[model samples]
Target chain A: MQQLNEQANIALKRTVIVAIFAAVAVVLSLVESLIPLNMGVPGAKLGLANIMVLTCLYFLRARDALMMVLLKTLLTAFIFGTFSSFLFSIMGALFSFVAMWFLLWVGRDKLSFIGISIVGGIAHNIGQLTAACIYFNTSKIFYYLPMLLIMGVLTGIAVGIAVRYLVPSLSKLSLFENFLG
Target chain B: MKRGDILLIGLVVVIALAFIIPRWFDRDSSEKNHNELRTAKITVDGKLFKEVELTQEEQTVEVENEHGLNILKIHDYGIEMIDADCPDKVCLSFGFVDRTGGTIICLPHKLMVEIQGPAEEDGIDATVK
Candidate 1:
């Protein structure tokens, strides 16, 4: 009974932490929105919120990672009134989670910026473009596929480097220690 | 860069070329096709709303829906979002759409711009949004 209670407490704590991260993600989402990259594309994003997601990953479980993503998506929609486009955001978030999680599994210890970022970037594009195709109801994804794929690689490299910069500091945090354990 | 780093750079260059070269070549053909005034479509939240014939000149369009303001620009044979109130200007930065396939989406606006050629089959998604 004691162990069950402890488990439930841990679960509750985990939920609260995830909620906090979701809030952080939302703040990061809006903050990043202000710092425009001017990358010369309509949808070109520096993918800023990725940093928060990566930070959460270092401080939470895979399930927590997934939850934070979904919560972030829904919340962003609610806040932005972009709920109608939730399908695209949901798909993109799911794709990014899978890619990031896979990198975590593969790198377990020696995670590289290039590999994870590459995967994350590719998955990001796939997620959005997939939603685009579904939204448009056409296989015309092929048209944007090439550019998006290239963009994925480039964006992955950038975000991967950012994550690499983050891992050392994040790993040192006591809050993150609970997550790692 | 050392031999290994040089090799990695070369590999990235190669992959980029594989994508960039094809797009560079196809750019012309797609541009040629887009020059004419062709019927284009707009969808909001998965519903087909309107189809407008696009001209080969710079035209500013204002689409006011419950979603938000959708600002469109048509230049030379391409159409894109010049501006939008959406937080993520992914649509505005998208730049242009060719006859092949392209989109400018303002999620906040619940607005989307899709271009399809009359002769171009399968470009239009059966489901609209």
Candidate 2:
């Protein structure tokens, strides 16, 4: 009976943390929209929400991180995007999540978190452009690839530095020690 | 930055430079040798829609079809997307394309406006669009 109660408590704690992170991801995306980056390339943003997603991935289980990404993408699209925008965000989120997860799994401690974030950022761009090319049925969309790749590398460095600072601070609090993966 | 992070960034920068430097040279060479008039080729869904010469006089080209509506303004030997009905409006953000080999693309509407030199012999498919 004690084991069962403890298991239930852990599950509830996990659920609450995931929900809070998802909300944070949504808010970060809203904040991102207010900043205009006129890079002369279409569909380029700072990927601010990625900070929260990366934090979730590091501290929580893979399933929890995936859940946060899905919730974030859905809420952002519903609030501030169209059907096509929704399609693009969903594709980017999935690609970033998969890349991050696979790198974390394969590299273990050999790879820095910053490197993983960079790959995720680039993967996100690739996924969005893939969606655009398929939708338009034209390969011309690749013209923007170089610009987007450079943007990804720069922004990935920013997000990765942020997460590096954030994880330690959150872990220091010890509020959810049992929940940390 | 960690060793791995530096390595990763180096690889990405190299790849980006590989793609960008050649295009920069292409644009520079195209601009120097071509003294004739330049034209803006607009394509929709990979098909040529209209080819307009870039002149001193400003002109507006309205592209409306099943996909969406895009308003292009041409003036001062350059072309810009003045307005668009597409949801993202990314094409408008491209500002202006004044040089040969420059391009403005609207993905939602499947529209592309590319500046080309007079001596360019390639047809639509040669553009790789």
Candidate 3:
């Protein structure tokens, strides 16, 4: 009976943490979209919400991180964007998640958070651009690829640095430690 | 920096440079042939909509489709999408295409504006086929 109670407590705590992360991701996405960082290019963004995703990936389970991504994408789209924007964002998030997961799994010791984040950024852009190409039915959209790549690298580095600082503090929290254990 | 960080940075730099260099050369040649841009073709849903001659007359072409409305401005130098109701506004950001072969596309509306060169060359190319 005691073990059952303990299991339920742990599950509740995990659910709470996941909800908190999802909320943070949504807020970050909203704030990032408010800034006019278009740089004369369409669909260019700072991707600040990626910080939360990276944090979740490193500290929480992969499934938890994916859940946060889905929540963030849907909520942000409903609040700040349109249906098309939601399509683009969901594609980007899925691609980013897959790339980050693959890199972290394969390069466990070989790559740092920054390297993985860069891969995530690149994958995100590729995913969005692929969707654009399919929708337009034209390959000329590739003209935007190089510029988006440059933007991705810069933003990825920024998000990675943020995660680097955030991870240590996050790991020290008793709640996270308890959940991990 | 770790080896991975160095490798990633190097890879990004190389890719950026590779794409930018060709575009830089293309821009130079296109600038030289600026006057070659004669007509602009607007297509919607893979069908021809309108063709505007790039002359000194500055006019606005309002395109309304199922998606929304787009305002295209045809100027002396070239043509551009001045405004669009599409969510992305990618077409508007394309600014102006003063060079032949340049295009502005709004994916949401399935609208495309492509600049064509002089009629003689286009006629010959069409006849050769």
Candidate 4:
């Protein structure tokens, strides 16, 4: 019974790990906001925090990717986005998470989080574009879609590589070991 | 190393496709709408006065009045103050905005000019929403 209690405590701690990554996501998001893309696409971003979310999906035991996405969406909305803006962000986050999850499932050990991250980025753009369509009620805005999608793939790769490097060392941490509990 | 991550990457690839497909319609929208829609809004002294539509057949400007006595013509890219009963036609100073989210404001005439884009787009089938 004591072993069972100890196992439960370990599980609880692992769950908290997902929140840690979510915190990392929030911090990275804030940092990226400062970077400010000069790119003409208006509101363009690299989405640096995606690395941490992807990493969370890989290293943690639980299905924490979904949780991380939820937390990031809620936190980022409260901090940087307007009430109306949250709808758009939710669209992006949900899409990106699903994309990342899909990549991980197919490739398994062969595909790195880098690949998954890249896919997520592309989805992120589509997600936002989708939100734009719903909000504006027209398809004309899609005139910008191709450029945004290409950008999404490239930026996803960039974030994914960063996650690739961060994951190994992060896994070494005791805190990380118990993160997904 | 999770299955979910693999699924996600596939989803992203599909999103890339979403952007690619739209190029088809944009080509038609731009090529076909030789006389694309022009959206405008006018304001006088920080007050909204009139919003007009200027078509693409050559170039021209129009002014509307509530009293029904005056009609103003605006030349190509030539947005100027029409004789408004207001104190000044300062709004006449700000010109046109054709691109997305473009706006022009006239302070004295209380005229504001805003060129709006297409009101709506077709449904988006990309991931998420």
The DockQ value obtained for model 1 is 0.34
Which of 1 and 4 is the better model by TM-score? 1
lDDT of 4 by residue, B79-125 (tens): 33344443222233223334434444322222345555455343544
Considering summed lDDT, which 10 consecutive residues are worst modelled in model 3 chain B? B120-129
Docking category for candidate 2?
Answer: medium
Off by over 4 Å in 3: A179-181, B45-48, B55-57, B86-90, B99-103, B107-110, B115-129
DockQ head-to-head 1 vs 3, winner: 3
| Top of the candidates by DockQ | 2
lDDT of 1 by residue, B9-98 (tens): 356557667876987778777656543556667888767777766776677777877766777777766677777766665676667675
Candidate 3 lDDT over residue span B49-106, tens digit each: 9998887679989999787899999886688899888865667778877776677887
Candidate models: Cα lDDT each = 0.69, 0.84, 0.80, 0.62
**Candidates' TM-scores?**
0.76, 0.86, 0.86, 0.63
The DockQ figures for the candidates are 0.34, 0.51, 0.47, 0.11
Off by over 4 Å in 1: A1-17, A107-113, A178-181, B1-17, B29-38, B44-53, B57-62, B71-75, B83-87, B118-129
lDDT per residue, candidate 2, B44-119, as tens digits?
9878899999876899999999998999999877899999998667898888788766778886687888887776
lDDT of 3: 0.80
Interface RMSD, candidates in the order listed: 4.5, 2.5, 2.5, 10.5
- Candidate 2 TM-score to native: 0.86
Models sorted by DockQ, best on top: 2, 3, 1, 4
Candidate 2 per-residue lDDT over residues A1-181, each given as its tens digit: 9999999988888788889999998998888777776765667778888888888888889999999899999999898777777898899899999999998888757677788888899899999889877875656667778988898898898888888898888887655788566
Residue B5 in model 2: lDDT: 82
* For model 2 chain A, the run of ten residues with the poorest summed lDDT: A132-141
Error of 3 at A43 (Å): 1.5
Q: Over 4 Å off in model 4, which ranges?
A: A178-181, B1-129
Error of 2 at B49 (Å): 5.4
